[model samples]
Target: MSESETTSLEAVDIVRILELLPHRYPFLLVDRIRDIDSDRSCIGIKNVTFNEPQFTGHFPTRPIFPGVLLLEGMAQTAGAICVLASLAKSKKPEQVYFMTIDKAKFRKPVIPGDTVEFHMTKLNQRRNMWWYRGEAKVDGAVVAEAELAAMLVLE
Candidate 1:
């Protein structure tokens, strides 16, 4: 889609997020999307809770959200941006697959009741591949950060 066309969108709710991405319960980390700047950047929300399945096994007593999941959430946000842009241009949804993750760092331990905000920015796009940089924050404090690469498969 043209820059202006996709940039017209300001936010995407759970319903739209469900339609744009394939992830479902237990795996779908993004609850809502806001501050979308077309395919350039976006913010994704994930509400962490004690009842989450991962917490049951990841740490029965300590219960810290997994770092890898944080990266996955950020990647999902980037994928949402790509899907939204593609839908705007072709009216067809595509699947985004993780290609690589680099320089991932965990800055803090995310526990239950913490709401994570995933901020993702597109660094570049070449053909079907997209490069992104993302950070996961809890209450304005960064918990994780990473550089991601993904491939968009046209369906």
Candidate 2:
């Protein structure tokens, strides 16, 4: 929909994230956003499960959520903020896309049944480009964090 139409508590679903982000299954990370303060901040969620593609190679019997993927989820969450921030700046949220990642750090292993919460906040938005800071937490403990960049296109 529109940036003005989105909100917190019940934010974007996987389908909505797919519509807003340039990612998909086997790659798409965030399952949903618990909160989205359009252009400001948002919290994304991912329920780690053994069925995920990464589990196939990330230790077959004992699967753990890949750290990079965790950062990716945070980036995607950051992307959502970037998307909304760009829309606020350019007036069209649909054109935004994630472009870069920086300062990514992973603290612990995330395994099956764990619910990762990705919290992202917009650091800046200059025209089509947006920058954000993100963090991933489980059980209220910091699991990962990063700084990410994204752009908005007219397509």
Give the per-residue lDDT digits (tens) of candidate 2, residues 1-155.
Answer: 45566543357788777877878788888888866777678889988888877889898988888888887787777776566555544555555565888888889889988999988887887767778888899999998888988777754
Query: Top model by lDDT, which number?
Result: 1
Q: For model 2, which pairs clash? A: none
RMSD of 1: 1.4
Compose the digit string of candidate 1's lDDT tens values, residues 72-109. Answer: 99988998888888777774755779899999999999
Every candidate's lDDT: 0.90, 0.77
Name the weakest run of 10 consecutive residues (lDDT summed) in model 1: 87-96
* Pairs clashing within candidate 1: none
TM-score of each: 0.94, 0.85
TM-score, structure 2 vs. true: 0.85
Model 1: lDDT of residue 28:
93
